[model samples]
Target chain A: MAGASFGYDPRRPVLRGIDMLVPRGRVVAIMGGSGCGKTTILRLVGGQLRPQEGSVRVDGQSVPDLGRDGLFALRRRIGMLFQFGALFTDMSVYENVAFPIREHTDLDESLIRDLVLMKLHAVGLRGAAQLYPNELSGGMARRVALARAIALDPTLVLYDEPFAGLDPISLGVVGQLIRQLNDALGITSVIVTHDVYESLKIVDYLYFVSAGRIVAHGTPDEVRRSTDPFVRQFVDGEPDGPVAFHYPARPYAEDFGIRAS
Target chain B: MTSVATGLRRVGAGTLRAIARVGFAARFFVAVVLQTPAALRRIQLTAREIYFAGVLSLVVIMVSGLFVGMVLGLQGYDVLVKYGAGDSLGIFVGLSLVRELGPVVAGLLFASRAGSAITAEIGLMKTTEQLSAMEMMAVDPLARIVAPRFWGGVIAMPLLAALFSAMGVFGAYLVGVRLIGVDDGTFWGNMQASIDFWPDITNGIVKSIVFGMAVSLIAVFEGYDAHPTAEGVSAATTRTVVGASLAILALDFVLTVFMFRGLGNT
Candidate 1:
């Protein structure tokens, strides 16, 4: 993505003049506080939303320029694990993993079954295939979603808050799996998250966003060692920083008539 | 003068919102229409939805049809007996069921039962991000999800209407012939003579089809456009019933005028 800007409502842009790159066979993390346009970047990468300015290019092709059919065609090469897993509740775990394969391929049931089981096995949930999404625990659902994301053997995988609601063990498992999967499958992975420590341990590089733009980006050690106040504030989880703790608003005292306006 | 300006502004804003809603609905209809051919390939999904939207609605429709027919029979018997034309009860009941009550009542019941369910289901799916997930997977949610349900509702409406009409005729028979002592031959004979195959029966089916399209489109569109929250899903489901019920009634009048009045002369 180059100089990409976007917003849900055109009058209030969320992401502004952001630029980033993800090299193949590497796990890159986009880290930010909530509502910092981390997920918006993933949306643009997946062609789910168009950038208001500049472009999101995947494989040297601009995303927003693609027509409907062209966009779907491009999307087939990409996989995304949404926040909360977003499993089809009506379908079983096995069916959830098999959905994209069935929709995009003419593979027979036997092959599809084998492929689904293999993907589930890779995520250590092969036995949970018969269960519904509602039956699975949060971590299990996220793992199943991870299995599904890699089912198509996509060239690029985007993870949105994969570690959000996971326990420490599950988080560690997911963080390791993300690193392992990218390396083993030779696929580029971009994870949007706020779990700074876990992400720093596994990611090849990190981009820390504040107010929709990247404030600092480097290898984990370099990011940690940087003296930039914004980066330092975020890295150390400080209460006060260049990014204010409070929203811009009217004065507290004047509203109570204790002081002149 | 300020009050007048405020009222005018409110009216203008309301009109613009209404226009925007109509435009959004039109676009949704077109998207569903275009995706229908692809949805056909996934017939099992559509069949399952038909069972939910159609087969599950059978009991309510059947019972309502029966009760409505019985009331019509009782009312018609009272009037016809006064006029010494008691045997014409079947003609009255049959004409009402085939020409108006069958399609309209079935449609209202369907909007309450099936249309509301469709909206809630889709709205919940949106809340859970399943639709967005499908889009990310390179599967058009309109083709996979909305179109199947749309076609399912369309296919189910006519069949349910037919069933309601048949049940209604039976209910009418039980009251008019067995209960009221109307001559059996006169009852059957008058109905056969009075109800035209082309104008009454076919036009009723046509009305059901149009109602089906309107209700299903409104249901799915509201669901698709709903805010992704619990309150949003609840509100969308409410709008589905209210909007579809109003659309069914309004469309019924327009269709009755066009199909019965204009076509009756020809």
Candidate 2:
């Protein structure tokens, strides 16, 4: 994406003049504080939302220009793992994994069965295929969702907050799976996350967003060594820096009538 | 003076918002209609929705229809006896059920039950990002999710109305003839003469179909437009019930006007 701008409300843009690139067959992370438009970028990339300005291009094709059919065709090549997995609660794990394949292809039930089981096995959830989404643990559900995302063998995979709420072990496992999947499938991966440590561990490059622009970006080592205050504050988990510790507001004394208005 | 101005402004704004909301809903309805042909390709999904929205509503409709018919029968018998027209009790019961009561009452019941359920289910799906997930998977949620439910409701409404009318007639028979000692032959003979298959039955079917489309459209549109939050889903579910019920009643009145305007002339 280049010079992409978007906002749910026109008066207040969430993402502004943004530019980013995901190299082929590499894992890249877009990280920022909460509400910094991280997820908006993912939506733009997935063709779920059109950028108000500039362009979001996936594989040399402009996304916003695509009609409904073109968009869906483009989406078939892009896999997105939403935050919280977003598994179909009504469907069994196996059916959820098989949904895209069934919707997009004419493969018979037997081949679909084999393909679904293979995807489940990769996520180590082959035995959980019969269970509904509500029956699975959070970690198990996320893994099932991961399996479903790759069901069509998409060339691009997007992960939105994949480690927001997970036990340490589960987090580590997910981090490992993300890295392994990208390499094993030869797919380009873009992960939007705030888990700096885990993300730095897995990602080949990082883009740190602040107030809707990429304030800093580089290799993990380069990012860690950067002297930029905002980057340093985020990387070191500091309490104060170029980013304020508190929201902009009126004076506390004036609000309490301690001073004349 | 300022307060008066503010009140007028608020009312004007509210009117405009209502119009916009209706426009939005109409567009959504058209989109779902356009997508229905594609949705039919997934016949099993539409069948499942019919089972959920139509088959599951059978018990309530059946019970309510029976009770409503019994009350109508008893009341009609009492009134007709005062006028020495007790033999025409079947005319009263059949006309009421076939023309107005069956379609309107069944529609109200359906709006409360199946329409609300569809809205809540879809709203929850939105809250959980399942709809978005489908979109990301190259599937149109409108085609995959909303269209099937819309068509299912439309197809089921007329059938459910017919069932309700049938049950209601049976209940009326039990009260008017077997219990009240009204002449059984007179009851059957009067009903047969009074209820025309086209004017009475067809109009009711048409009313139910229209009500079904209105209610289902409102339900799905509310769900699709719901904010992806717990409170938002709850609010959308409530709106679906209120909006669908009102739409059904309003549409019934308009349809009644049109249907009865040139009754004997037709």
Candidate 3:
């Protein structure tokens, strides 16, 4: 079958027309190595940037149909755990969690506090209420950003490299929280990351992007046996063979292999 | 593309873009005006900016004013004494301080200290993506960040300008009446009678407010738009300080011309 394609470019589709549906209450992982546009797909889906061709629809509204206010409201419905948590260093933990509620709603102080505490509790950070973002460990900061994300009870949550910088223990804790929260909150989840084995263990289904396209999609067992060269090489994380070195040569270099230095 | 077409488009877009950006700035000051009723609501941050703009600026304003007053006194005395109107030293120092020198000098001090700092702070925040985080979380950065500062500088400039005028008069009094051996009573009495409140003092207050808004607004705009890269941040910071300082000087000239024209007849 021809690879159906469209994405940031019209003439050359980023996704090659591949399609993957995210059900409302399941966790799906999109895995790809660095420079594979994994984060671009997430940004496209999350409305950070518009698809250059075709469309991205969140709950039937075209991404561009949303104005600033609409996009803000749409984003509030989707929690994002940005790389390294992206917590504002200026706000304390409680205030970070309370930020969305304060902006989007007119909840009274008591109600706002109650909601912030609940999200913090769910993330196992109820005790860190008064702490500033800088005071938290990597795992704790990610959890605080997670808590802030889920403060408004979003229907879908996007994790952009949630486990990128965590230690093994912290990674395990975060992986488990994603699973636990998925089950407990009944929220659809999309994780964009490169932590192959750990991500396979946590996710229900997998989509792999390569060269700005969704190269593979399946259950864990199906993807494990795939023969696609790029997919195989990526899953194996090999430094050589098949994938080949494609680094940018210097501007003055005459040919690809010539080492100008 | 034809050169003429490109040039025309550039000119057209540049004009519109500047107008829009200026409107963006005007909106910020308007927001500050709107929030004046709730001045007590955001008291802490406003007070912090005020203290930063005011108390920390005291030394610079005083020293600069003393020197400025002394220089203006000497220059005005020299020029007037050539006509044997040495008695007009009071008129020279008092009118210059109240009408022009006072506000511009205080604003220059502020443009250096507060203006550079505002630009750098906002530039750092921009490069770090903290400003984006604020927007995503629905923080009205203009209301929270820029507005307090614009108004704080506005209030601070006049207060500093008044202090400037006082010190300048004192400096002139020292240099003119004592050192130059002019009559003390005539100098003192002439200044009091010649200095009118409306066109001189009120005009200083008005220009300083405008100067304060321009300096703070340009600094924040340039800083908030600084790129994440270090080179961009440095460029933005430099641009902000230079741009704000130039803008203050230009506006002071324009306002002076229009102001004296309007008041000259009266």
TM value for model 2: 0.97
Whole-model Cα lDDT of every candidate shown, in order: 0.92, 0.92, 0.79
Measure candidate 3: CA RMSD.
5.0
Ten-residue stretch with the least lDDT total in model 2 chain A = A252-261
Question: Once superposed on the true structure, which residue ranges of model 2 sit more than 4 Å away at CA?
Answer: B1-12
Task: Look at candidate 2 and give me any clashing residue pairs.
Answer: none
Residue pairs in collision within model 1:
none
Name the regions of candidate 3 deviating beyond 4 angstroms: A1-18, A241-244, A248-261, B1-59, B70-87, B138-160, B170-185
lDDT of 1 by residue, A192-214 (tens): 99998999999999998989899
Of 1 and 3, the candidate ranking higher by lDDT = 1
Best by TM-score: 2
Writing each residue's lDDT as its tens digit, candidate 2 over B236-265 gives 989998988898889988999899787763
Query: How good is the docking of model 2, as DockQ?
Result: 0.92
- Clashes in each model (backbone N, CA, C under 3 Å)? 0, 0, 4
